[model samples]
Target: MVKLIHTLVDHSDDVNYCAFSSSCLASCSLDKTIRLYSLNNFIELPYSPLKGHTYAVHCCCFSPSGHILASCSTDGTTMLWDTHNGQTLAVLKQPHGSPVRVCRFSPDSTYLVSGAADGSIVLWNVQSLKLYRSGSVKDGSLVACAFSPNGNLFVTGSSCGDLTIWDDKMRCLYNEKAHDLGVTCCDFSSHTVSDGEQGSRYFRMASCGQDNQIKLWLISFVDFLGCELKYECTLNGHTAPVLACAFSYDGQMLVSGSVDKSIIIHDTKTRSILHTLTQHTRYVTTCAFAPDIPLLATGSMDKTVNIWQFDPKQHCTGSLLEDEPKMSVENWSEEEVSVWLCAQGLKDLVGIFKMHNIDGKELLSLTKHSLTNDLKIESLGLRTKVFRKIEELRIKVDSVSLGIPDEFLCPITRELMKEPVIAADGYSYEKEAMENWISKKRRSSPMTNLPLHSLVLIPNRTLKMAINRWLETQQKYNETT
Candidate 1:
């Protein structure tokens, strides 16, 4: 199921976009500050928030190696920041007549691409930190731009739904109408194509727009005539305008978020909706799945970023289970199984069966007598409905789920410190709470009312590790028992 782990609400204005790196997550806002948060500790990094842009930062992207972060803004400029120390690397301001709506880094991190509302696409050289070149269309504003997986080709999508494909040398290779209204988002998959048709399927790109539909474009390589772009298929389900779409690292699943406040995870091979995640209440502005982890990060106009992960045990048997006739119990796709499970409730003994690593079909194959008398299920009702029949054996959550020992509790809030910091008063506390006391409230630490020497909040990594280990142990004990 798509569980909302955290609702980040630091931005004063609308959170325009969210991007992820290996160890950090970056978000830009209309507040005109780009903030970086630590993924490991879930706390805002110190000395963060590169604040040079004059206007609302619209979009941000991290390089392939997670070293550099590039952001664009309404100020008509792009700023490159060092992700390590939160320092501004360079500012490539070309003075385009319109706001730079989108920015992307090449796979190799050698080039940076920016698309502006003025219909211009600028390719900047990363090493030289200068304008490598630029391309423009006659009309319409460019809303999105993406470099091909190979980085040799790039694409620009406009407000008029026009798509222009360009090469590394800034030459237009393909120009055509792609969607109705405007193209809001586009993503490319250059990862090795799955299946035997790898001979011709060199690259594929998925595009979504205000028209409420998604089109997949497949580019095939020819012997001598270069590459050709052909329409592969169109996916339809979203009733409202689709805002953003991203492919997983493996390029096997594509997730799209829409103004309808829902996310649809689709199978890239079958072109079918594997799951529909409806966790966001407002229009989801952007969605990106982690290239390495199973986490999916989504940002909304509601001023929040949610992290979702796919868990295998929670899924109900349906989509992939239908193929259980041909395959054994061990051959299920964990992601697909999770998608089906997120939609339904956990049925009684079914959850136990799943926890015990019992196959879904094997449970369905049992008769009512076998289910009740042998497996100890009183009444399963029917096999089809047993997908959600997982209540009886559900994990017993305690009043305090983490069950952290009293020693780990913060001195002020009484809650376990997610970001524990050792204040100078010889007391440990949540950093934000401690900061509020000493910095904002102009008072000394609660433990020692005497004026403190310093307000520096040194992170307590050892204590945090202890807290995390305790939480993980309790969570695993709950899950298994």
Candidate 2:
């Protein structure tokens, strides 16, 4: 049975997107802001109404660690903010200056990809917020994007009715005409379907569109050189244009919202309707499933977000929180450490770990010297291996601490800008590089390939000051390290 737990009626305009982390829920709206809520009691967080965007906020997503939140807007910029304090971390401007419609973080949270209305896609390195790669589709307002569970591939859907697949390097892997009218939204299932082989795996993806239909696809990552996308089936449960769709954390159920003012839940395995809810009075725009709980959030044009709870037994056989409690490795007990060691193929180390009473805190603090001196490991290879694993764990536990600031590098030289200059194209570049290009009779912007309206270049003193501050901070950090 499905039960409505709470209704959030805070937004004054149409809600565009909604997302859930393990501890918080975020929703963005046409009111030009994003709101945060605590999952404990569905109370609005103090960081609610993040107001950096100049226009309507279209989409928002939480990183894998939930320490960072990304929101894209009609202002042609995607901003990353500290989820805990609502402080702006970085602002990434679209190259074409088109309104960004969607943004998603890779499974590993190493990369952030944003899609613009001009069909442009920019992949940003999350650590430094530098532009990693940029590409454009043939035609369409890029509307939807989702990363595969494995983080090796991502798929984007456009208003031109095309679904295109891309790799980590932003290379086009596959493209297909998915919907006749226009694709509104798409999502990849969280779980992978094994083909009874050690390496072969197939992922199920769902896409809903203006055609009033949802299509299922079987995506194969079996071969990196030649990925495949095969049509599985079509779901026609919604009566009107389906705006949003998402797979549950367990991948056993799929939910979608549509212009029919209703939400539909489907049994993905049986391809049958489990429930149909008509609680919203207007078009339902977005929906999401909590990663750790049996809760579902749906947003609508009625300017409200409804949170629902589903019985775990009715949807799946196992408990929903079975694998979710280990989210905070820092809070793990000594016994949990032993189990983790065995799972990491280091069963031999579990005995030593238990003897030393090594819990999550101890594991995170293990360095090469500690592993050799404290743990009394003489073998160089084994000590290096243990230290490496611990470092990886540290990264997963607190990745936000590793990232710095953004857009401090010149797009032309791909280096830190010494004398920043703003051209007519509205992008900052190294003054020397821009002057050299202008002197060489190049009357176009190096980044945009568009004609330069004038040769006059304006000095960006603000950017120069920001870069200097960052340099000073880095110098101090290096000295301390």
The model with the greatest lDDT is 2
Deviation (Å) of 360 in candidate 2: 58
Question: What's the TM-score of each model vs. the native?
Answer: 0.65, 0.65
**CA lDDT of every candidate:** 0.73, 0.86
Q: Backbone collision count in every prediction? A: 11, 0
Cα lDDT tens digits, model 1, 375-398, are 565544443344222221121011
Those runs of model 2 whose alpha carbons end farther than 4 Å from true positions after fitting are 194-200, 222-224, 317-481
Cα lDDT over the full model 1: 0.73
